[model samples]
Target chain A: MAAIPEALAELVSDMESISDRNERAELLIETADRFGDFRVPASIASKPYPEDHRVKACESDAYVWAVDRPDGTLDFYFDVLNPQGLSAMAMSTILAETLNGQPLDSVAAVNSEIVFKLFGKDLSMGKGAGLMGIISVVQTEAKKRLAAR
Target chain B: MSVSITERGYVNPGVLVSTDWVAEHQQDANVRIIESNEDPLLYSAGHIAGAVQVDWTRDLNDQLRRDYLNKASFEALMSRIGVTHDTTIVLYGDKNNWWATYAFWVFQLFGHTNAKVMDGGRAKWEKEGRPLTREIPAYAPTAYTAPERDDASIRAFRDQVLKHVEAGGPLVDVRSPAEYTGEKLHMPEYPQEGAIRGGHIPGAKSVPWARAVNTEDGTFKPAEELKQIYEQEQGLDPNSELIAYCRIGERSSHTWFVLTYLLGFKNVKNYDGSWTEWGNLVGVPIEK
Candidate 1:
């Protein structure tokens, strides 16, 4: 496996350290509360996003966009259409925070198992798929960028 | 404007409570407002004031098996949540009360008949500018006792579903049209919950679960509209023994609640194993 991004690996480590479910929940909730700050800007994308950009199997109607940075790294932005989709929002926020500006190879190497590490194994299969879908889109974007080079 | 819960002409209108009703009763000692959600982080982020969280997986399900909690565990859960035998459970959550109705179905397994779902659920409550709090409330534990779970009345197992299929009994496939047609298989990444085979049970009618609710605000459609969808559109017989199934039964439980309570279907059961079990079973009749 390719090396995990430093920031994402650190975040996963921090989450894994907390044994209490409530504490982990509080952390995730706090992260989700910051979702607005990481939302896709109108300048990059807007309402009625294209179907191609939408995450598959995600009930939250989440959309992901990767903007090319001048230095060849990517800046990821996400929009979760369902307002009650807090988990999707949190996953988006985490991806934006940890994956943005990372090496394309490292970002692409990030696996879906990180979802379980960050959110815990108790996530329902549907919920797990949705969260992993967000990561899959992000990694796909990174892989596309690397291949283009 | 949507019609009030009572004016919706449901046969069992008492099974649904509006956000307004919940607002007035948030402080009622006899009512326990429980928020059960699919998103694990939602309850901790913010929820209705005085409402306690009952996680669908942790609080309701059996930790060791795929089944639900037993009688002793149910009693322990009630005691932990400070609910008595008479404490009314008003369940609401995200996904248009999908998880809420699912929790309601589990409560029924334990024979908690006093439970009702909050129409429209957390979205409506939040959209209406109702107050939500992160402050979890603590209620003194109560001496709650529950009878053994009765799976016969409203639940269907794999064998029963097979028998029903053989008998040509009426069944409702509450999944999306793609899932019903077997055009969409389970996500390969999550194999444990995925079905190797696609398609639905034989002789099942495809009426997506969301048809029972209004998409604008996630409220159950008025009884007239529901009847048109279930009866007129799909030709489901209200008097017959009907079984509803979705991927894992959570979505179908919403349908079970609708047919059993809203449309007043006399006999409705939720096949919790649903497509996952049926699709994987050997030699079961399947229809795409």
Candidate 2:
């Protein structure tokens, strides 16, 4: 199936000169008329900003953006704009463990979630669990498709 | 066969059509698609062609104070936007589904069910290589008669939130860890003291907004998966009252839509005050 229909493309490519809000609203209504029922994967929607990632740490600000593997395919991005005296090395170590499946020692795990009492430790663990669940499901589905093929 | 009353509510009274669906039905004459962007001046550079720009933070909000979702003000907003119950309105904005969900929840608060967040929003529409025009279309003013506000369907004041807390209802914090834990409040604004002095509200669980979605596309997770995420990982009971919140209720709005629209949670509310109002208060207790 086509990702974007043709009539809609004509409208998007020419969106540079519109000024009046009313006219724009009308055009969108018209465009929606041309191509509104299109369905695509939920994961295919966000605009990617993979290359522009950074990590910074200071007394107040700690923004960490690191690529787990140099391949740049599955890099993790975390931006902590302000740190209440969190250690940079400690933060990195936690992120590495959370993303790379490394073991977290007692002290590391304690400081990992920051507010250990609330929200629980292994904060990103939920995400990892979700990803693993999806991967397994996708693999099973893929095998089924392959067998059918 | 005629639809039953229970089935009637889920059929979204207004336009819940997709971007493509709207494109085909654009000739309906009563529909209006507004590009609810952050900045209209920047909007002029380009928008969904023929789409009008609405500055949500400024125009749609009650800027004098933090009271944006009051009934009187919300009614005026609907009337001024040329929206009526019959108007097939689709609201969207940049940054994926961020602002789109916010707009969707606002319309729902006013009891307008026809409104929908264009799936994938402007990002997907643009990515699909659909047409984005420069000419803006003018809309004739329409009279929108709002039904009695469905207060139960929406999250209201701190009193209601406190009630939920007392009842052991689920309060889902959709903000990032930084905001949830009082690590960083408003980004690039305020004193970064976060919306609250401590961490999250008592009895609230932290579930970042991004987790319910696939980061690549702005659409929600599959219904079954979403159900699992909330019921198991997040520990949200479907039968229990689920109220979601963020710094200013935007992120939580998305969660509200997911729980109510997709997951079919009967009692769900979006705490409009969110952290901004809840956390900023002097005496309101907070939990880390």
DockQ of each: 0.84, 0.02
| lDDT tens readout by residue for model 1, B47-125 | 9999999998899889999899999999999999999979999999998999999999999998899999999999999
Query: What C-alpha lDDT, on a 0 to 100 scale, does residue A37 get in candidate 2?
Result: 25
Over the stretch A8-51, how does candidate 2's per-residue lDDT look in tens digits? 23333454255554455344334333221221123433223232
Query: lDDT tens string, model 2, B1-288?
Result: 222213334423233345677577556656667776432222444556556555556555666665455666666666766677777677776545666677777767677777666666666666667776666566665565665556566766788888778777779998778767877655222233245364788888898877766556554555556767787887888777778888767778878877777667778888877787788888776887
Error of 1 at B230 (Å): 1.1
Name the runs in model 2 displaced over 4 angstroms.
A1-149, B1-16, B39-42, B69-81, B147-152, B186-196
User: Largest TM-score belongs to which candidate?
Assistant: 1
lDDT of 1 by residue, A1-149 (tens): 57978989999999988899999999998899899988999998878898999998688999999999999999999999988788899999999999889899999999987888898888888899999999999999999999988
lDDT for position A146 in model 2: 34
Accuracy of chain B in candidate 2 (TM-score): 0.84
Compute the lDDT of residue B43 as modeled in candidate 2. Answer: 46
Judging by DockQ against the true structure, name the best candidate.
1
Question: What is the C-alpha local distance difference test score of each model?
Answer: 0.92, 0.54
